[model samples]
Target: MNTASSDQFNEYASIYEDMSQWPFRKYIEIPSVFQEIGDVDGLSILDFGCGTGMYARWLKQRGAGQVVGYDLTEGMLNYARRRAEKEDLDISFVSHLGPELIGQFDLVLGVYVLPYATTRPELQAMCADMVRLMRPGGRLLTLPIHPVYDPHPNYYEPYGFRLIAEDPENPYADGERVKLELCKNGEQGGVFAWYWSATSLERALEQAGLRSLKWRELSASAYPDANQAPKELHAYLQRPHSIIIEGVRG
Candidate 1:
């Protein structure tokens, strides 16, 4: 991670957890992720780039056999550990991953992790790391900028955030820069991410030995609270800004 990105996460770590509760995340992103993840009971799962470790704790509470939260930001990891302790969850929070983690997990959940790859090489290495941690036939689920991302940054404002592309004219160009804007505690904050075409993302995963590449749009109906969710949420789902990518480590 770049120094600026690291510093951004560390500085905003306190307000970061609120993101998990963002309208889109709660109604669409979260549901879409967990629905495809299916049964986690007795599954070994890794929450890569686990921001505040919300997913990590949730996985353990849901009966995941072994759950580990890994990230590069210390501030977030610190809060994650503290929360885990309070919940009396026996989840492990690691600051880094090594070869020891290879093939150690049955499922790897990398929510909003891939866009951090600022370059094609970085994307490839990140994919390699993801594939490295999964046992054979283990599945991977991740989210990245949708190839058909809405060009108007504010289109998702109703969802509490928006993404701006560095090259508006060529927003979907591989490795393009993108900015995510959000507000927390009445303060505005943002993070820089990259855009990877579906093709480029697939190539990286395939080269890393992940098979059965599949791309799908986020479905609001997958949400546990779908019935009560505002009908408007489906609009964002229809014009999704990010998409889900599923694969198996072969």
Candidate 2:
């Protein structure tokens, strides 16, 4: 990971676990990821780029046989480890993934991971790592920022977030960087992430030997009490806030 991105998330570690429960993540991101993942009973799973191990814990709660969480940021890994210890959940949260992890998982999933790649080579390497960790026929699922999303200055208001184009000049041209500013009831924090189009992502995955790419939009109905969700999120019912990418190692 690049220094700036790493620092951003490392700084975010202290607040990530709490911030994650915000409506957007609780309603949209988590549900969408689980929908794509379906069932995990008795499966060995990897939570790639797992920040604070929230999904890893969820997997264990849902009866996954084994779960390993990996993150580049030390703070994130520490927080994840602390949580695992507190709950006595049998999860291994590691700072890195080495050769020993290759082909170790039946299901590998990442949330908001790919956009951290920052460059074509980085993105390709990230895909290669994900494919490397999966057993043949094992699945790879990811939830990432929608590539085609055009951020309007105030469009994110309903979600209590803002997206600013750091380099307005030539922004949204594949692999460009975008800044995501988070806010909830007046508190503020944010992170920088790379932008990747669907076409480019597919090419990278194919290059890494993953096949049968399937794209699914995040659904509002997937959220709990969908009818009670804010009107701002209603817009996402028509337009996507994020997407689920599912593929298989063959």
Candidate 3:
């Protein structure tokens, strides 16, 4: 990740927990993420790019064995560590990709992590990192911007964030810059990330020693709060802004 990206997320660290409370994330994204993760009981796991330790804590509480969270921003890592301490969760939070974490996890999960790679080589390195962290036969479950995300930035404003195409004329071009505007309850901030085409994403994972790559659409209807979700949820689901990709280490 670039300095600008780290600096941007450091600023967001203070409000990251609040943003995680957005209704879409609460009612849809969370369930979708966990559904793909499946049973974590006794499984050693790595929460790659685990901002705020949200999923790491949850995974630990759900019986994941030795859950560890890794990220690039110290601000984010500090928040995650503090939260883990407060919650009495024994998860480890680290900022570096050291040898200690390699080939040690039964599963590697990265939520919104791949997008932070601002270049294809960075993306490739990240995918390779995920593979390195996982033990043989371990799985990877990650979320990245949907290949068909809505080009209109404001379309998702109602849900507390916006996805702006950095290049308005060519939003979906491979490796194009995409700006994310996160807002809610009078607090707001934004960040820049790059978009990856489905082909590139798959190839990155495959080249990094992962196999059986699959993409699944997140459905608000599958959430337990589906009935309580507002009408806009259907539209969000129709043209989902994020997607799930899972594979096993070969």
Would you list the rank order by TM-score, best first?
3, 1, 2
Off by over 4 Å in 1: 2-4, 184-187, 222-229
lDDT of each candidate versus the true structure: 0.85, 0.82, 0.86
lDDT by residue (1-250, candidate 3, tens digit) is: 6556767888677677776677678767888888778889999999998988889999999999999998888889989999899989999898887898889999999999888888999899989999999999999998999998999978888888889988989989988999888766554868888899899899999999999988988866464564566776866766778999999999
Model 3: lDDT to the true structure? 0.86
Distance (Å) between predicted and true CA of 246, model 2?
0.4
The candidate scoring highest on lDDT is 3
Please give the distance, in angstroms, between residue 35's alpha carbon in candidate 2 and its true position after superposition. 1.7
Tell me the tens digit of each residue's lDDT in model 2 across 1-250: 5556676787677567875677667777777778778889999999999999999999999999889998888889888999899999999988778888899899999888998998999999999999999999999998767875656645676677776677777656788778888775675778888888888899998899899999987765554665677776776655565688899998
Error of 2 at 212 (Å): 0.4
lDDT of 1 by residue, 1-250 (tens): 4445555688667667877788788777887888888899999999988988998988898899999898888888889999999999999899778778889999999988888887888899989998899999999999988888897978888777778998889888888999888743443778898989988999999999999998878877644554456787866866888889999999
